[model samples]
Target: MVKYFHNGLDHYFREGDLNKVLSLCLHRFEEHGDLGTEFFIYIENAILKNKEYVLQNLKNMPSDFALRGVVEYGLGCIAASEFRLESTIEHLRNAFSLSMKVLDVFENEHGFCKSVVPFIAKEAYNLKPYDNLKDEEILLPKIKFSKIEKETDFFVLASCNGIYFDRYFEEFYETIRQHNENNIYHIHIANPTSQTEKLIAELDDPNFKFSFENTNRGASYFACMRLFIARRLMENYNCGCLVSDIDVRWIKSPSKIWAGLNKADFGWYPKPGPAPSLLVHAQIIAFSKTQKAFEILEKSNQFLAYKLSEFPSWCLDQSSLFRAVCLTPEAKTQDFRETLGDIETVQRLPDTSLTEKQAFRAFENIEISMNSDGYPILSRVD
Candidate 1:
């Protein structure tokens, strides 16, 4: 069986015999007890099914549902992106509720969950609540992008240079193609470097790419972030821009923002959350070349690059950009709201769906103390 499978790798892929290839892997799983090979086949199958095999494996996990939660979150992410799911609050609530089980109850799995946040974010983009302007809003004739006598084409910027960047390229490219199809976006990549560039190069190869500019500035998050933002602005070719870090992908149609660009006042608002009152700069801003957009981008980039000494090293590019936005009235006062940091906050674990055993186990790792009556309490400690 192993020999047959070995010889048939090309045959299965060439002949589109996915099931046959899967069967061979399952056979190998039984024969060799190799969980790695099992997961390899399982992930592929899950993608085909749109539920990610992570769920199936966890359904029968040897007694680690928390770990299963970890896997489920990853799978949930894959399931979210590959499938065009329903965009209802109930579903988002479901994911958020489930993730709590995984994140809160699995103390033993803390390191594991943290390790996969990037990959998880890629997948999570697929599974969350997607809201768009109402039909009345969308029905309003989209402002034709050509009206402004602008020489600029819309540049949808994404920076995907890290480890999970390659695994999520298929997902990312799907989004790029969708935007491109709308004739509203010309996707460009700012992926400075990663291990899987060769595979990424083979896969559609971005319309534009860049080499990372080393500042010899060590691993300080402050310096690197300044560099990223500076590079994003310095490298932009478009006269207009819709930019975001690679982390928070578009869960729904980005067309609104495309049109929003045409009408945006380019102001800022305090987008505070229930979590904390954090200050944020304009993430998604749009204005024509004649407008202050380019000036702001150039000025912000240069300013952040030099003022790296102002913000803490941990705040990174977003922080630097926030600082720039604060100083510039054109940027700081914009009413434009781009859903930037939304992806990272996705709730994908299935806490409520957990069996009682699963729920109780989660309670153990949930660091916060439970009352004598057994109600869990939230602690300041993470």
Candidate 2:
């Protein structure tokens, strides 16, 4: 399920109605001298209707203001949409430089502006104007696993590209080390560098082993690889696996909860909502070493490949995994409180006042209530 953070303007922009959003943007600009949101809306609308006007307006913006950098970044997006290669690079480069100045000023400021700078920097580095790269160029590095030499109770699997490695993986590793020291961990790394190897060595746990994949396929491909890895471990070694995103941290060991569900082939936490929504939360999933679980994973892998080829932009491994669960006969929804006990998925919000620990406690409170009532609750705090 998708959740949107309300900036006290969601009612005005109901259902993302562009006209209503634009009207409110204009009103906000006039009342508060805040043109950041308004400029973005105008640039989005002008992408197809009037590119020249968008460019002119971006160029005329005061270069001293931080908002100008955001405007330029929007122009870069528009240029890429229009396949204007040289223009895309130029605008993006300018945006990068201007945004750096803004970052210096707002480095300590809370909320949306501060949260967006790193994203802009990442996009500036990764965005390529070329459209004719080969399949091999787009394909992630090939993955190979070390032979399973010992019988392990369960495998915890995760993957990350270069961008998320430092930002999330290090903390994830530390949390697991502190909370789940007994469980074996097999971390699959994509596009591993010397730095990554050094970090793994420093972690220096006997139970923790890592394998590297050569390609840096995007997140969707990494998600696919996760399923593939889980299935392989089950098939070859008769071991169960728990797959989780790197952002997830274990506040307590969940091994007992998972082990108790011996009859289940596959288990997942449904996206919090009313019954019949049945949308599986793909971030954390468990699979027993069973044929049914292997079959579901195989089908999920196939579906992901199909989506990648047919609708690359629209495709997501989470969506594909949900579909796989729906099709599988033995897949069951496990309560988050029961399986994860005291786990939390940490998300950095635009609001700095709302620290991650605070966010986690808030979620724990909701989960505690839901667990008592046997109802799924959906909430987002930003």
Residue range 239-301, candidate 1, lDDT tens digits: 445554343344444555555444442433233321000133333444444444545555445
**Least well predicted 10-residue stretch by lDDT in candidate 1:** 135-144
* Error of model 2, residue 167, in angstroms: 2.1
Q: Which stretches of candidate 2 lie over 4 Å from their true place?
A: 1-143, 147-149, 260-262, 273-278, 330-382
Model 2 per-residue lDDT tens digits across residues 1-382:
0012124234433344444545654555456443453444444445434445344545555566556667777667655544354565567656656655554444443332423443344334333222332322223334455566678667787766655565666777776676655666777777777777668778867777676776634555665667756776556545888777776555545475456445577776554321111234565677878777777776666655554543232124554555455567555545454644433442221222345335223322111112122211222223
Model 2 RMSD in Å is 15.7
| Cα RMSD, each candidate | 17.7, 15.7
The TM-score, computed over Cα atoms with residue i paired to residue i, of candidate 2 is 0.51
